[model samples]
Target: MPPETARLPLAHALALGALHGPAELVPVSSSAHVELIPRLLGWPSAALPADVRKAFAVALHAGTLAGLLVLVPLPSPGFAVVATAPAAAAGLLLEDPIERRLGGVRATAAGLVAGSALLVAADARGATGRGAAEAGPADALWLGAAQALALWPGLSRLGLTVAAARLRGFDRGAAFALGRQAGLPVVAGATGLKAWRLARRGVDPGLRAPFAAGAGAALAATLAAAPLRRVTSVWPPAAERVALAAVALAGLRRSPR
Candidate 1:
């Protein structure tokens, strides 16, 4: 197919970009939404080449990272490095295989369900005592492991890290802070790596406009939703994941396999 003809439409790109901000800022899996929303809506973008989809997703993440850099302060340098290392290594080694093997609707949906359960259970049991300033190496390791596990499409980086923080006995505020802090480095690293690869490969001229539009929309949406970072309750997002998962599973069952 001609590159121009194969590119995702501008409107779809903008819509997904807008969705990425809040979805990413919260515990919901932005990647799952990016993958499933177009398919659920029967948008042709869902059928675009995997490379195109992946590139667009990376662009969206780049925008989110930019917004986060403006809105959230970084954690201690040592803690941030420790918390980001495992996921960075995991992304280097396993990203391609995970995308190839588990990027399907079924696996994504399963991840959503599983992640929702973990979030709810962790929140229910977690004590509200420890603060972000008190986070130690053990907490960093736990958060790093959670971030690595989140490489699965539906296991959100924010969600899993928050759950990990909670399980480590951090309060909701601390957990939320830790999740955002831990996630920033990982997102920044991954976005930088993927952006470099995309640049080397050279994006099609025809698709550049859509990519720019999506990234701008994501940045705007993320800035607009900055207040949401203060929200520590995980119930709403957890429920949302379950509902989205159900929609995905139902759609999958009804589609021609």
Candidate 2:
């Protein structure tokens, strides 16, 4: 159930989980962690059964995602939660397809490039006079649509949400807060529903360990959020987005398989 649990060094396990958690929630892609970690650790493919690996990854997301939902300072958590619903629903429906063919190294690299470009563009626009206002339901719906794009492995969920918010006229802080808050319910609802279904089917519930990882990730995300905001403010939002996208894409390309 817990990956090939022959008692991997506890340090390795925790380190892996911790690193992935924070990195996943930022503008970076979580899938990149799943793809990169194994190679970095020289972990064998068989170390975790495929299903276990997937479940663990999802669980980790839940934890960090949940942490953000509960902890982040936002204008309206309720509105944020409401906005994220459609994207979450879309994620639930498309999970299977995303898992099967999200693509390999090449595709991931390409996605990073695309995502970076978008980030740079966002940064270029700058937060100067944007993202200050609260978003409306229509704006939230549009943001949700942007988030759906993040289902792609390399796309940054935060980036998409921010982009959508900006497009709808929210300033930087507001956009970031909106995106961060919106994801809260999606993580909780999906994780709870899946765990429930698994239990109903008589599957071991321990399979949900990644959720813990996600919580750790949420802490990590908080640490990063403020710094990231400051950095983005230094540039035009659109340009910053594009710059980040290129850098991430270059890293993806250079990473060893």
Candidate 3:
């Protein structure tokens, strides 16, 4: 998804938000969905500035973070604080440079494939009582590091975290629970940081309508997630994400925006 050529209107903004809410919950990369939704829907090819795209993504994430709070039991507050460290550090210190270098459509598509592979591998492992029940400081550190991969566009934060947990012996539900808990802080931190930066620079009045529309769509999708995700096992992500990445990469032959 090269910078969108056309202004993202309220309807399109809501479309992107609807995609983000559930994709973030599943193994699919929410960022990848955002990157593709515009193009996939036949938006114009004009180069959308990166900052606008970034701002929209940040706002969408905030809406979903709010949704997570309602549907899941968070890890203890102390655990949430310490566990969020590595990804938070990576986002604050490394995300900009990474986005500069690897935020391209091709690069992001590759991330989608890479992340999808991880999900498929985790699925292949099947459910086993071999799952571990212990949560310790070491677990927090390890999971946090794994989640740092999410700073890269098209890398699914939920996908990587759940994959890490599943590999470490957490059952599917447990992995999902832990991943959600670990994710909240990172999402909150990044959203807050981006909001601060936007405020400091002063937001463009043009951006407000789309941002509000996107956030509202996300909130609605998130509220419906409980029933939606119950039937959304790991299989669809394992398969659908690869197809999505392939489609995205195929359409990405245009010169860099």
Candidate 4:
């Protein structure tokens, strides 16, 4: 059979292209989408190709960068810089070992289940209060450390950051915002690595594509706000996340290796 095409609807195309950045800033799973969309569409491969995945990451981060710029008009670029330092440091330190050996589907699934449980318990305990608060430099560093856990693929940076924030006594909105702010540069770095890998592989330069994709992702992030607001407003990201993890794990268990 010929390679199947994963056709994108205009909106979804634009959204997927645009939403990478902020969508991830929230407690949603962008990597899960990266892994799931191709499977759902029955495309040539189970996951998107490295090039496409890279493009998607760049696009989403672009949107996120845009959203952050728009949202924070003044006096926080320093905060963004500081917050990302730990994740960047941790990522560089762990890249070889994590990607070479520990990163796998089963591990990702287990991380998902565990992360989901954490979210559920924290939410049920009413740990994430309402509104934002001041996060210390230490908190930012710790949150960055928490984000490194997401390198395993199934672990979500947002989920982990939010969970960490809740544990640190940040109210819900504060934890979410802090997590988003901290994660922005991490995704940007991932996009840059993807670009570097693509360049090393002699792929054509995608200068225009990243911008277009970022815009698309921005739109998606905007649209996603409604559902996310409604869902997260209820707290306990654990319930839905656990259900999703269970389903993904069950499917993995049944799939032919």
lDDT of 2 by residue, 1-257 (tens): 45354333434445655665555345666565555555544565325555555555555565555545545555366566556777788888897887678755556555666776776576556344544454667877777777778877777676677666766666666776676666555555666776665455443444333345444654565455545533324134334334544554555557643
Q: How close is candidate 1 to the true structure, as a TM-score?
A: 0.97
How many times do residue backbones clash in model 2?
37
Considering lDDT, which of the candidate structures 1 and 2 is the better prediction for this target? 1
Q: Model 3, 133-252: lDDT tens per residue? A: 476667677678878877777778888888877777777777776777788787778788888887787656776788888988898888877775564377778678788877777776
lDDT of 4: 0.60
Q: Candidates 1 and 3: which is better by lDDT?
A: 1
lDDT of 4 at 123: 49
**In model 3, which regions exceed 4 Å deviation?**
1-6, 44-46, 130-133, 254-257
Q: Lowest-lDDT window of 10 residues in candidate 2? A: 229-238
The candidate with the higher TM-score, 3 or 4, is 3
Q: lDDT (0-100) at residue 109 of candidate 3?
A: 83
What range of 10 consecutive residues in model 1 has the weakest lDDT sum?
1-10
**Candidate 1 local lDDT, 7-54, one digit each (tens):** 588998899999998787899999999899899899988888888888
lDDT against the true structure, each candidate: 0.89, 0.58, 0.75, 0.60
- Screening candidate 3 with a backbone cut-off below 3 angstroms (N, C-alpha, C), the clashing residue pairs are 3-48, 5-46, 131-169
lDDT of 1 at 122: 92
